[model samples]
Target chain A: MNIRGLSLETIPPIFTPFRFFLSAPLSGILAAILLIYSGTDIWLTRWNINNLALTHLLTIGFMLIVMLGALYQFIPVMTGQLIPGSKKLASSIHIMISLGVLTLVTGFLSHSRIFFILALFFLGIGLCLFAGSLLPLLIARLQNQLIVFLLRILYLVLMVTLGLGLYMLLAHAVPSLEIDFRNYTDLHVLWGLAGWIVLIIMAISSQVIPMFYVTPEFSRNYLKMLSLAILITLVSLSLYQGGYIKALEVLLTLELLIFVVYTLHLIGQRKRKIADVTIYFFRLSLVSLLVGIIIWWLGRYLAQQTFYFLLAIVMIYGLAISAITGMLHKIAAFLIFLHLQKLSLSRPTAISLVPNMKQVISSQNSWIQFMLFLLSYAFILVSVFFPQLTVLAGVFMLLSFSWLAYCLFQAIRRYQKIQLEILALPEMKMSI
Target chain B: MAREIILDVSELEPPQPFEEVLKQLRKLQAGEYIKMLHRKQPLPLIQLLHENGYAVSMSNSPSGLWEIIIWKMSDPVSAADCNTQFGTNIIQADVSSNR
Candidate 1:
């Protein structure tokens, strides 16, 4: 077992994580609105200005936002390592990143050098502040555990990816910088998506699947070696030429295939066969990842430009976003209940008013939200082929994120209201 | 001999595990302490127990699961007996007050 920081105390206050979670979906909602506004033009090619904006909206806004929030919560709770100056530091990180994403999206859509400069500024501070605070702690954590090890890799990847992104943005910001925007942009995307995002997801899911769901543990050595294998392939992709690149791509795909198959195997072995909404999200994410891999293979073999765009859509909206949305539902509900339970520990008489996880966010409501997200996924997949269906896809996407926002809002409201009740108790009044 | 309340929540998910532990605690008698088997250390539950004047001692079982012993501090002997019975070190927590 990966015993590292179980003895450490101090999970950050609930709002520390929730602030990131609540705002992350707004980017998804904005991306959908952009699609509704642009319609067919947004589906034309990945290079289209509005399409680039939409991609950032999902990537930085939705995926990275949720991840930063998770790391804020996870590093402390799982590793038993507390973040120093977390409240002020966390708030600053959130604001900078939220502005970074908005300005980045605006920069993409407007093709303005000034907005690009602003994005570069905001994202730079936000990402640096994040890495500055956590990277040292993660590196210093003394364990041969896979999570700590993989988190180190994740931080390094983020730094390198940020370096590549800086170069790309500088070319736009300064206009005369000696940078091959097209060639290097591909490297930035590869490092950001495949290296940074994919590896972190792999590391976390390996830990939580068994820990939370009563499934068999993923082999620690296997995952560690796989992390190295992916790093090797991504490094090889950046260095190699035409013929060798195809082989490298195959190596990465094989790694993903193993992940999908093994995850499905683990899910099948779950002691409790009753599936939750989070399980469905994972299954959907797995299938979408497989679908993305297939699309890439077909697009490469057939030399069809359209399939590449389809591949991008599947990976971003279908795989990453779907998983994150499901994660928000599960984590937010639990934290609300857990923190409320903490409140009642002080005011023992108010214990009954602190609802269980199910009461906080009903299974039926979450399942319905998951269904909406799946429909949004389908409409988006279809829209890639039929450009006219773009607006309809956008509408469904908006509804899914809006409802996610509502669900989160209600859960937080419950937390606040119950908090007020606990403070108002007769015992509380007398103690005061 | 102190009575034992065996709780094996190795398969239950979150909030359910917390609820089950609390429910089981309410049913305890003066001479009993819970011998709870869990997959991971239930740290939050342990904290709550100590705050409410319950004592806890935990160590890994042969089954590779955590075996946590919880009792009222007034009944420390039962918790100590459990440590001896399970061949675990006695690592008691007594916060006694939340405020």
Candidate 2:
């Protein structure tokens, strides 16, 4: 149990978390771009097998892939332990997951059962490999209360979602399986969104937000209670979808209230009082989340198609994308800083190793993206009922996401350049 | 007259632990200065000290060891000082520096 002596070559403890950092936001960007191009006019009509393909493109391609990578990186840091798997195993899992997402999306779009089955097999295998690789690290470092709890819940939700996904895919191929795809799909989305993604984000944010911004620590009791409440609501809603609607509504409202209060508290207490673009992004995201909840609640009561579309746009494009974009700016800068700091320690060179955080992501471009996203989101909300303005919103969304993707690419390129510079240092020649 | 307090932190576990040493040094001798020799970048620790009220000067030795010189501040006492002053487990002062 000598954590310090763990070979750095065996997938740097941070590598897994870094993977999530890269994959998650990029997945959102990709999904947004795809949806924009496909035209916003199409309503739930888009929720067919083809749209399922698009869904996986976001969920599996973007969400799970990023989550897996994050788990790899963050788990070790949290537990003060390293993953037991080799780098090759991690690479294989990445490849399999990527291929599986592509294949699954294509299968859903083409209505090809063979490809559908193949997609399930590949994705399932990839997930299993990932889980297997991470299990030891998770088990070994069960002492870290916050991280261990988050990791365990994340893995459980992932397993349930993946199992349900596989079952649904198989049922599509062979209808005699007696499994209800609709129920399973709904449960999968709930678990994936609420149970896995949100829980982990909350857990990590409780630690990182204070550390990064030099804010006071959040109340541990409040955080623990919120986590449990969210988990219980998600499980209850899954089991009793119809009966638990009122309860779910109350719980969701409570959760959002807690989040808003906590986020505002953190921002208010932040030591760095400078105007940060990332903080602005977070503000926009919180607003979007509020709008989304209102839309969902309205949709349930009014039965309006407009409310439904607005809810989707707010949640998927608005809150999700905004938070992701904001995080990418920080994560990219932080990783580069970490890598350079490691190098600077090893090699005492006069090289200006640290890249200014502001330089990593263009504030102007991010603000532009934020404005465009908001505009497009508003237009889409209007177009859902009007229908004629759909093409205009679609165009705006296309431009906004494209610009976001470009910004991300530039940031990554800058990071890569820094990496190359560090690698080129004569005294610090070690494989990354 | 300028006096140099040498701290051989070759055996220091990590940056955080090393900072504990800095804190103790700051407390034991208020006016005397420090020139830390360590095999790792002590910039973070230096920055921490600076933020906490100590004025620091940093340089690199020819043999790749980092040298950080910290000077005590000549100012009114602050709240952070009270905490650090009374904090018993802040640093392992018993672990004698090899220098």
lDDT of 1 by residue, A90-166 (tens): 99999998999898888888888899899889988998898888867875744437777778777777777878887
**In model 1, which regions exceed 4 Å deviation?**
A1-8, A301-304, A426-432, B1-4, B50-55, B74-99
Whole-model lDDT, model 1: 0.78
Model 2 lDDT per residue over A138-256, tens place: 66634446656666666776787788888887887776787678767667766765566566456656655655555666776677677777777777787775866897868877797
How does residue A67 of candidate 1 score in lDDT?
Answer: 88
TM-score of 1: 0.91
Best by lDDT: 1
For candidate 1 chain A, the 10 contiguous residues with the lowest summed lDDT are A1-10
Cα deviation at A367, candidate 1, in Å, is: 2.1
Chain A TM-score of prediction number 1: 0.94
Candidate 2 residues lying further than 4 Å off, grouped into runs, are: A1-33, A44-46, A141-143, A176-178, A241-245, A418-432, B1-99
Candidate 2 DockQ, CA atoms: 0.05
